[model samples]
Target: MLKEAVKKQLHEGTVIPAHPLALTSEKKLDEAGQRALTRYYIDAGVGGIAVGVHTTQFEIRNPEFNLYEKVLKLAIEEMEKGNTPDSFIKIAGICGPVEQALAEAEFSKSIGYDLGLLSMGGLNHLTEDELIDRTEQVAAVIPVFGFYLQPAVGGRIFTFDFWKRFADIPNVQAIKIAPFDRYHSFDVVRAVCHSKRNDEIALYTGNDDNIVNDLLTTYHIRSGDEKIEKKIVGGLLGHWSVWTKKVVEMFANIKDVQGEAQIPSNLLTLGQEITDANAAFFDSSNSFKGSIAGINEVLRRQGLLQGNWCLLEKEKLSPGQAEEIDRVYRSYPHLHDDEFVKANLTKWFDERQ
Candidate 1:
């Protein structure tokens, strides 16, 4: 039923889309670049996209909202483009302020997005009532896909009660779960997915580090383990899924039952590799800023991303670090060549016998 639901969404413009690893302007989308980005996903067989329209000082006090306006116009243009299947999957994204997000949400609906969500970044901890009120405001406008990420990555995380409140909104179809504490991913996925009042609300993982494991494991069990082994969450949205085409392909292939018997090895290998990579780039290994920079570089080298576009990552790459990234990932080769991507992808899903 869950697989069918996901497939239905995929067929209905439900692309398990990727998000920005970094919001910095080191590289970014221009008119040509945005179209190129849309094409990149279509080529990769991805269904849709979620562009981040960022804003600063959203503390609800300084009072300058609508900061993400230009970004929204760009993303909305892509969303609005009337096109074919290879052209249109789905477009999910975030706008800065609640009011602006509401307008953007309505626009996304008007433009035919499968799902629309608001970024919880710079969001102050609203009271349960306030959260519900705001959520209903958006839910009434569009299919409210909740961006329920913890604020570990320079954003604010909400409380369980806050989620319970938000989920109560009728159109709250899903939540993007990227918790600061890894275990919170498990916890929130459980709490949100199993809510009697929120059964319709799905949990999608945004933590790239946990993508394979997240998509492969079961998290429905609260206290015990009947072992819901078929996986619950839909997919990664942030760093993991952005340029990791091979990983997504591996995932798409893994969804096939005939491929299930062979999934464990590749799943483990891929999960571990991604986890280690993210850790080195995101967690203890370096600053979150550096990780996004590294990921963008990886995407550029792989040719899935445009070199002209860059996020304004707070961390700067060292003199040789950029070259070193190319040199290091060359051994893997999947990062660059499509033939190599296909080869590794085949090994992961087909040759595992």
Candidate 2:
């Protein structure tokens, strides 16, 4: 069970970046670079970090690589070293089949992780009932942060019924809705709002394409005879992995106007600017083939990463992706955290040494 204070922190909302992997040119984990990235996130003032998710590359689970435990250990160590608050969330990504997922959940809990960001990718072979059973088994070991990944990625779609039942689980504390489809996104929200445990489950947006709007709009969902209100309290996003300081500041500004009768026109415009930047960073043009590498490119430019390397050799930036990143960099100087990283990159690295 989550401590009341930790649960309160999640309900109040905060930014939690989907942590990325730092690799050397030899395709080996750069221990120093990995530690530096963790320190960078803490210093950026983010409320939490979600490691081993899609942004961290699923290939890390391969026996050839076997970086799952090492990556999680590295992040928690840095979090401890930084003296983060108890409310600073630690999420370990849990994936694979029922047996593998259960083992990952148990390992994550043993290492002081607070929640397991459960992924349902590569499990289409299982029925929705079977999937729910799998989730229940994992939840028995640790609290769950349900993930609805977009099909454009490796994610498969789940029915609204699946979400309703999933939310009914007592150990499920939150959900990251990122199907990237407005209708499907609504399905998850409506299901959760209709569930008996709605109040206990925090809704976090994984929809990187619509981050600003998701946070600003409140949903008045109709479930049978009653109307229920729900809001996406925060984001656990891959887009946030880059320009984190700016993202943190953006989230704060959004929160300030969340309760206002009329949102400022400037904030709406800023949303498009952010989506435009996401298009470049996430490679929305080429079906996101370069998405992960695109994030690495930004960090590489900021000097946080030695290079943009993925476990899979074919996962490099797609054609014209670099130009798109450059265009956004030129167009939206306000959105980049280059200056923040510049002033602190040396210090972050120095701490690791």
**lDDT of model 1 at residue 10?**
41
C-alpha RMSD values across all candidates? 7.5, 0.9
For residues 183-301, write the lDDT of model 2, one tens digit per residue: 99999999999899999999999998998999999999887898998999999999999999999999999999996789998889998999999999889988988999999999999
Name the lDDT of candidate 2: 0.93
Candidate 2 error regions (>4 Å): 351-353
Q: Highest TM-score, which number?
A: 2
RMSD of 2: 0.9
Model 1: per-residue Cα lDDT over 1-353, one tens digit each: 12344435542222365544223243333444444444454445555566542211122122342323444454455444424454343545644557877876776666556566666665575555766687777777777667655555555656665666666668676776766467666656555644554447666666656766766665436524333322444653655444445655666655553225445576577667666555543433443544445655655554444551333324445445565565535544443335543443322222121
Q: Candidate 1 — which residues are off by over 4 angstroms?
A: 1-7, 10-15, 19-29, 53-89, 197-199, 222-230, 240-244, 257-263, 280-284, 302-315, 318-324, 335-353
